[model samples]
Target: MNKKVTILNDKHQRPPEFSAGSCTVTVYSLQPWWRVDLLAQYQISSVVITNRVDCCSQRIDGAEIRIGNSLENDGNNNPRCAVIKYTSDSSSYNFSCNMIGRYVNVIIPQNGTTLTLCEVEVYGVLGAISLQTDVALGKIATQSSSSYPMFLAPFAIDGNRDSNVYAMSCSYTDYYFKPWWRVDLLIEYQISSVVITNRGDCCPTRIDGAEIRIGNSLENNGNNNPRCAVITDIPAGSSSTFSCDMIGRYVNVVIPKNGAILTLCEVEIYGVPAVTKKINLRVKFHTSEDMIDSTTRHNVFQQFQMVSALKLYWTQEPELEHENKGFSDPSPVHYIQR
Candidate 1:
């Protein structure tokens, strides 16, 4: 248990203390994490984090908010809401999660840092197809290797950041060549974008040259999926948002088969559920008989009148026959497959 002296030191616990001087102080460790369970799943709209009002308010900087269901790694592997880079005198930070989840974790990653929270307020409602909902909720997260125990593959999606020096704050692959991390959405989606958080404490460059791919192919850990983005460079403890705009069920981040460490604080996938659209067909018939003499035409007109009265028909064109038949009306009416 990373130490939280402030939360323990506070004399009043009825309403959370707003001052860092009066509330909780985390131990100086890598990836100090704090979590709250909503008890039931919800489509979260936003999270409001209150920082210490007194000195060391900056301790809250670079912190991240993760929301999701999986208690794997104690909810540290949930999808991220956002990262805090700066704070004002108000010390109140709001991040739009727009996702569904049962647990919310706030963590600081890397080393030589402490996480202090005066209070954390979560605002959300029952689940719905909310635009703010993170599609990565309860999705399966995996990695190429499990070199470190605490920084295993699950931490990346646990929605927590490893801000302190402890090795437990981030995900790590073996020293093996070509390390990778992948998440299965269970179903296909039109991924609009992906947001990735990198370790801030140290070795931020370890993630450079990582390829983000999206597709259903499991070959090479979905590395063969369409390329979404390649991480050229990203700062420690900060996140980069990439536009994928691709369709797939798996999202992968892999480093080419080169020996390099792959660490991720968090990965967020956002998009709408994939749906199949049916092709609409317009059928027309032709005959040699005159419009008035045609029995089929009379029947069609009657049917159209009834259907149209019920407002089931969308369009009507009496001259459509001429358009299909062409000039002089072809006698041996042929159905044009237009």
Candidate 2:
């Protein structure tokens, strides 16, 4: 059916300007079986004509592409066509037509439509390099010397750079002794620098300090715990080697042999510097009878009130000597002491 469609700028029937050369015309059909196909027959160098669907269909079974043509199975043998003829430049170009149906309508840019150019680029790599290190403070033997190593993983992006290393330790026990600990970190290496921080409840009262020993001689000793200590400014990816000696009294308090099970209370790392950060350390120690004695004191005090109540006098005591004399011996004093 041949129908005349009025293209208006508003619902009030206002006619808009229709550009002459390379103008885009969009055709929409209300019929359920209507199919449309767009093709660019002629190409223009400076201008391009494109068509797109605008509105969508409300029908549940209907679907459409808003910017393209419809690819529906219609009995009509003649295929619908949207032809674009370029009147300006003379360059043949490729055109693409998307499908639209009851779900969508079409919209086209007018001849004088201004278009801007856009560009995009992407970049990526196959692999990346990373570095990591882990430090673990080991247990120090009582009245004996023990050492633990801090693991270091030296990695490189292109090449390996040998770097210097340093070790650090934090005291987690509360024992009456120097709040800080020092180990002969380096045996023969020179310390470029050292930093320490009093972590945990080790400050305000105790002066936090450390002694750096190289081989048999002490390198440095101070009361200030450095936050960032560096033996040497090594390469970009290197490590340092050092140890710390935690100086504290052994938590070995002997208990009486007859004492009960003793719970070793928390050991306090005393003498911490005032500037130390609060840190909690876990220390495992053998229990002693002193702990048992303290617990016993608590238990005895808890039953003290009940025991005191039982001691109140409720009855008079009998005089055993007078009662043994029998009724005849006492004479007039026959009645035993009441």
Best by TM-score: 1
Models, CA RMSD each? 12.9, 34.2
Q: What is the per-residue lDDT of model 2 for residues 213-242, given as tens digits with 9 covering 90 to 100? A: 222322222223322222222112111223
**In model 1, what lDDT does residue 47 have?**
69
- Model 2 gets an lDDT of 0.22
| Top candidate when judged by lDDT against the true structure | 1
Deviating ranges (above 4 Å) for candidate 2: 1-169, 177-180, 184-187, 200-205, 208-338
Error of 1 at 67 (Å): 13
The local lDDT score (0 to 100) that residue 280 gets in candidate 1 is 31
Clashes of 1: 34
Per residue, candidate 1 scores C-alpha lDDT tens digits across 1-338 of 11111223334332334433455667898789888777777766566666775567777777778888899988988866667765464666655555678888988866778888776767777654456335775788888888557877666766554443265656778776888889999988888888777777778788889999999889877888889999997656666768788888999999985788788887778898776443333545554445544575556556645644222222332333446444222133212111
The TM-score obtained by model 1 is 0.48
